[model samples]
Target: MSQPIPNFYAVIPAGGVGSRLWPLSRADAPKFLHDLTGSGHSLLRDTWDRLEPLTGPDRIAVVTGRAHRAAVEEQLPDIADLNVFLESEPRDSAAAIGLAAAILHRREPDVIIGSFAADHVIRGTRVFEFAVRDAVEVAREGYVCTIGIAPSEPAVGFGYIKRGSELIVDGARDASLVERFVEKPDLETAKRYVADRDYLWNAGMFISRADVLLAEIEASNPSLHAGLIALAEAWDDRDLRGPAVDRIWPTLPKIAIDYVVAEPAAERGRLAVVPGHFDWDDVGDFASLAKLNSHGRKNDLAILGENARILSDAASGIVVSHTNRVISLIGVKDIVVVDTPDALLVTTSEHAQRVKGVVDALKLTGRSDVL
Candidate 1:
C-alpha cells in the first residue's frame, strides 16, 4: 500500500556507535544493529517497521557509513537498493539529512521528509502515527516541524524544547511555535523545566518539505547547501555519484543538524513542534535501556538475552548475556554485568554513563579488534 500522504519520504541517519552500551554495542556492529529491547527485530529494522506505515516501504532512505553499508543492506533486504545512501565516512547529521533532502527533492518536488534516528524506541504506535500525521501537516505549510516528546519526569539526560504560541494550521491543532531549544541542563534546571508547562524533551526528529528544508540551509549555510545540490545532480547517475561524493563529502562541514538548522530556524520563527505523548527513549546507555525494557527491576537480576542462567540472592541489577554461560551473582546489589564471548563489562547502573569512557580507554590502547 502507498502512503496516506501523496508525496512523503523518511530519512534515517544511522551513524554514531553507542559507546555507553559497550561489550554489546560495538564499533563494527553499532547499537542500531542490535535489539536493545528484545523486540525480535534489530533497532534499524524496528525503525523501518515504524515508518513504513506512514511513508510506504519504498519511500524511505537510510544514510549510513561505508563500513556498515553491507550490514544495512543485509538487514533491510527489501528496501530499494538506491534508497540506501552510503557515505564515505561520517560527516555528521547536517550533511546526512541535507543530502537526503536534496536528492528526494530533486525527484519529488513536493515531498514531505521526516528525519528520525535509527536507534530510538517508541511505544503507543497509534500516538506516534498521530504525531507524524500532524507533523506532516505542519511541514506542508512551510515550517520545519519537530516531534517534541512530552516530559514524564525531570530528566537531565535529554535536551529540552520550550514551546511558545499555539499554531492554527489545519490538521495540526496541537502544533506550537518553537520558542527556543535548550541544552542538557543540571538536575535543578531539569526539574524546573518539567515543572514548567511549556517544556518538552527534544527527540531530534524533524519533518519538513524537502525544498523548504534546503532553502533554510541555503540561507544559513550556503556552502553545504551548494555541495548537496552538486551531489543531487549526480544521484540519478550511479557512476557519477560515487566520485562526486568522495571528492566533496569530506569537505562538507562536520556539524549537527540542531545547531546549523533547527535552532536557527526556531529563532527565525520557521520552526513548529508537534507535542507527542508517546513513550520515547534514545537508549544512550544501559541504565536507560534498563528502564525501557523489563531489565530495570530493583529486586531481581534483569536478564536481557535468552542464554543466561541467573541465580541471585538479594542481588539486583541488569544482565545481558551473549554467550551460553551461567552468570551467578550473590548478594551484590546494583551491579551491571554483561557477558560476551570476547569481553565482559561490570559496573553499576549509577555509573552507567561512564561506560563511554571505557570505550575511549580502549581507543587509547588501540583495541580496535574488540571495538
Candidate 2:
C-alpha cells in the first residue's frame, strides 16, 4: 500500500449547482451528493475516498456553501469540523480555494495543497495516485502543478492545456512546463488540438504550496488576497470568523482560480503539467452520466436507482428513476428520462448540454419549487 504524504493536503471545492443534470441535481441536493455512478456512495463520498488514502481525513478539507455543510459532513464523517470551510455566499473558485489555501497556510506553513473538484469520476486508482505523487513532487519545487488528462476524444466542452518541454524534476519525470491554458474551443479547433498530441484536458486539478497559491493570488489580485487573509486569520476563532466572513466574502471578486491564478501563472512560466492516464469523467450532463453507468445493461440502455420496471422495446438511452413507477420506451433512441418526486425531465442525449437553459428559464419564470 502507498503511504500517505506527510505534508500533502487536499482541498475539495464542492460549490456549483449542477443545473445541467437538472431534476436529478438540484440546488438543495447538487450532483456531488448523488450516487450517479451507482457506486453506492455519493460523488462527494467517492472523492473523499479517493483522497483520504493519500492525505488521510485530517489533512483533507472541504470548501462548500453553508447550505451544503451538513450534507458534506454527513458524507465525510471523518473530516474534522474545523476542516470544513463554509462560505456565506457564492464567491466563485478563486475565493473558495484561496480561503482554504490561506487557512491551511496559517495552520501549516510548509503545507502542499492540491485542489480537486468533488464531482469527477476517475478509474485506475493506482495511476491516479502516482500522478498525484508526481504532482506533489513538482509542487514542492515551487511550481503550480496541474494534473492534465490525456484527451481520449476531441471534447469541446473542456478546456485544453498546452504542454511545453518536460521538466527534469526528480520523482516527477513526466512533468512538463505548461505553455498555455485555452478555453473551450469550437469543434474544428478541438479536433486539431487532439491531433497535435501537444494538448491535455484541463481537468481543473491543481497542486501547489499553500503560501505559493496565496502569493500568486496576491500578486494577481491584491484585494481578493487581502480579504482572504482577513478571513483566514479569524477562521479558527468562532467569534471572529462569522463577523469577518459576513463583512468580507460578498465584497471579494467573483472569479475562477483559472483566471486569477493558473492561466496567468502559465504565461509567467510558473505552471507545470503532469499527464494523468486514468479514465475520468466530470459527468457534466446526462449524456456523460449515461456513458459512465452504461455497463452490464441490455442494448445500450443505462439505468440508475431501483428501476425495477424499466422496459425498452426498441429504445436505447438512459433512465434515471427515483420513483417505482413503470417507465417504458418504445422506439426512442439516445433519450434521457429523469424522474424525480417533484420534477420529471425528458430530453434526448443530443440536448443534454442544453438542460441548463431549462433551469434558467424556470428561474426567470419564478418557479423555484422545481429548481
Candidate 3:
C-alpha cells in the first residue's frame, strides 16, 4: 500500500446533471450517483475508493449540491460534516472545486489539493498511485500539476493537453511544462495531436497547493476569487455558510477550471502536466460505458446492466437495461437501447452524443418529471 502524502487533500467536484446519460442519469440523481460500471457501488463511491489510498479516508472532500448531500453522505458513511462541502446552487466546476480548495486552505495553509471528477473510471491502481505521487511531489514544488492521460486514440470527445519542455525538479522527472490546453478538437486535429507525441488527453485531474490554486484564480478571475474567499471565511459558521452560498455563489462566474485556472496558469508558465499511462475513461455517454464491457467481437452485443434479463439475437450493439423486463434485440446492429422506468431511449452508437438533445427537448416540452 502506498503511504498517504503529507497534508494532501483530494477534492471531488460531483455536481453536474449528466443529461447526456439521461433517463438513467436524472437531475436529482446524476451519473455520479449511478453504478454505470456495474461495480455494485455508485461512481461517487468508486471515486472515494480511488483517492482513499493517497489521502486516507478523512482527507477527502466531496463538493456537491445541497440536495445531493444526503446521497453523498449515504454513499460515503465515513465522510465528515466538513468534508462534505454542500453548494446551495450549481456554479460550475470552478466554484465547486475552488470552494473546497479555499476551505481546506483555511484549515491547512500548506495543504496540497488534488481535484478529480466524481464520475471517472480508472484501472491499474499501482500506475495511478505512481502518477498521483509524482503529481504531489510536483505540487509541493509550488507548481499546479495536472495528470495528463496518454491518448490511446484520436478521440475528439475529450480535450487535449500540449506538453512542453520537462521540468528539472527532484522526485518529478516525468513532469513536463504544459504549453497550453486545447478544447475538444475536430477529428483531423485530434488525429494530428495523437500522432504528434506531445499532446495528451486533458483528464481534468489537478494537484497543487491550496494557496497556489487560489492565487491563480485571483489573478485570472478576481471576482470568483473574492466570492470563494468570502465563503471560505464563513464555512465553519452554519448561520453564515447558508447565506453566503445563497448570495455569492450565483454571482460567481460559471466557468470550468480549464479556462479560469489551469489554462491561464499554463500560459503564465505556472502549470505542469504529469503524463499518466493508465486505463482511464470519463464515461461521458452510454457508448463510453459500453467500451468497458465490449467483447471485442463485432457480432457480440455489449450489455452494461443486469445480464439475466438480457438476450441478444443477431444484434451487435450496446444494451443498457435498468428495467425489470427482458431486453431482447433481434437483427439490430450498432444500436443503443437504454431502458428505464420513466423513459426508454433507442438510438445508435453514432448518435449517442445526441442524447443531450433529448433532455433539452424534454425540458422545452415541459417534461420535468422525467428529466
TM-score of each: 0.96, 0.97, 0.97
Ranking by lDDT: 2, 1, 3
The best candidate by lDDT is 2
Better of 2 and 3 by lDDT: 2
At residue 310, give the lDDT of candidate 1: 76
How far residue 333's Cα lies from its native spot in candidate 1, in Å, is 2.2
lDDT of each: 0.90, 0.92, 0.89
| Candidate 1 structure quality by residue, lDDT tens digits, 1-371 | 43556677999999988999998998798999998888888899999988889988798899999999889988898789879998899999999999999999998899899999999998888888889999999999999999999998898999999999999899986999999999999999999998997999999999999999999889889999999999999988979998998889999999899987899999999999999999899998888877776533556667788667777777777788898887788887777888889999999879999998998999899886787
Q: How much lDDT does candidate 1 score?
A: 0.90
Candidate 3 lDDT by residue in tens digits, 7-49:
8999999998788888878988999998877778998999899
Cα distance off (Å), candidate 3, residue 121: 1.0
Q: How displaced is residue 300 in candidate 1, in Å?
A: 3.8
TM-score of model 1 vs. true structure: 0.96
